[model samples]
Target: MGRALAGAVVAAAVAVATLTGCSLRIEEASCGGGEYPVLAVNSGGGDCVPDGEEPAQGWARYPEGKVPEKVGDEWDIYWSTHTLDENGEIIELPEGG
Candidate 1:
């Protein structure tokens, strides 16, 4: 009994350590009928942001209609509808958008 318990404890510890190396957050959004697409929020990715003098809010659209992309499986894209409008125009609501 003692040996079995020790083995179980060691197995649990190893499992936890192996899983601790990565983050497992569940983002709240769906794109292309799947979880949120991976977006470079405020140029936070390790890669350098493109040359742009001003910051603008825009969603990262998929290249095509592919659903099982990296963004859906691995990363998540997040956005808020309240993003500022530049033109100050009354935009009509998009149907089922």
Candidate 2:
């Protein structure tokens, strides 16, 4: 009886840990009010614009191959020190980036 109870407790603990770990991953940021998010070109900045509205000056859509859909995702991290030029080429940010 003691061994069975210990085994059950261990199983429960493992299940809880697995569930907690799954929930701990960072989720994508949300843009409410029907607005979508955009990142600035040549800088580590971002904004949320109304749906169907174009990005404001200095702000642009992320490139096709490097769009960041989740907060702290791979592309999100990459864009921290990189940006697109007027010609849409990726370039390293200048000093103080």
Candidate 3:
């Protein structure tokens, strides 16, 4: 029957491309007072202290709603004026650590 309907449409197009081609990769987490300025999403990577500096310990990934807390798995410290929000924009916090 038409090769079983073309093998069920190629197995439903490879299961919808593996569930929408997956997405969640944000590495680089290690701050000791050098090379700051980072912003990863998906749940990993952070360190963008841009408000006078002097706050770069480790962990930081805010870009989904200005996450103030609830970030574990990594995050020693990160200010950046509380992850920006008050006209400077760049808020949507919430990923992981």
Candidate 3 Cα misplacement greater than 4 A, ranges: 1-30, 41-44, 47-88, 94-97
Model 2 CA deviation exceeding 4 Å by range? 1-15, 18-23
Clash count (model 2, backbone only): 0
Enumerate residue pairs that collide in model 2: none
Worst 10 residues of 2 by lDDT: 22-31
TM-score, every prediction: 0.22, 0.65, 0.19
Q: Score candidate 2 by TM-score against the native.
A: 0.65
Whole-model alpha-carbon lDDT for candidate 3: 0.47
Prediction-by-prediction clash tally? 0, 0, 9
RMSD (Å) of each candidate, 1 decimal:
13.0, 6.2, 12.9
Top lDDT model: 2
Instruction: Give the Cα lDDT of each candidate.
Output: 0.37, 0.78, 0.47
Ranking by TM-score: 2, 1, 3
Off by over 4 Å in 1: 22-97
True-vs-predicted CA distance for residue 62, candidate 3, Å = 9.6
Tens digits of per-residue lDDT, candidate 2, 1-97, equal 9999999998888789798884335576635658876777777677788989999889888777776766788887888888877777788988777
| Native-referenced Cα lDDT, model 1 | 0.37
In candidate 3, what are the lDDT values of residues 39-82, reduced to their tens digit?
43323345456545553343344444434332332333443223
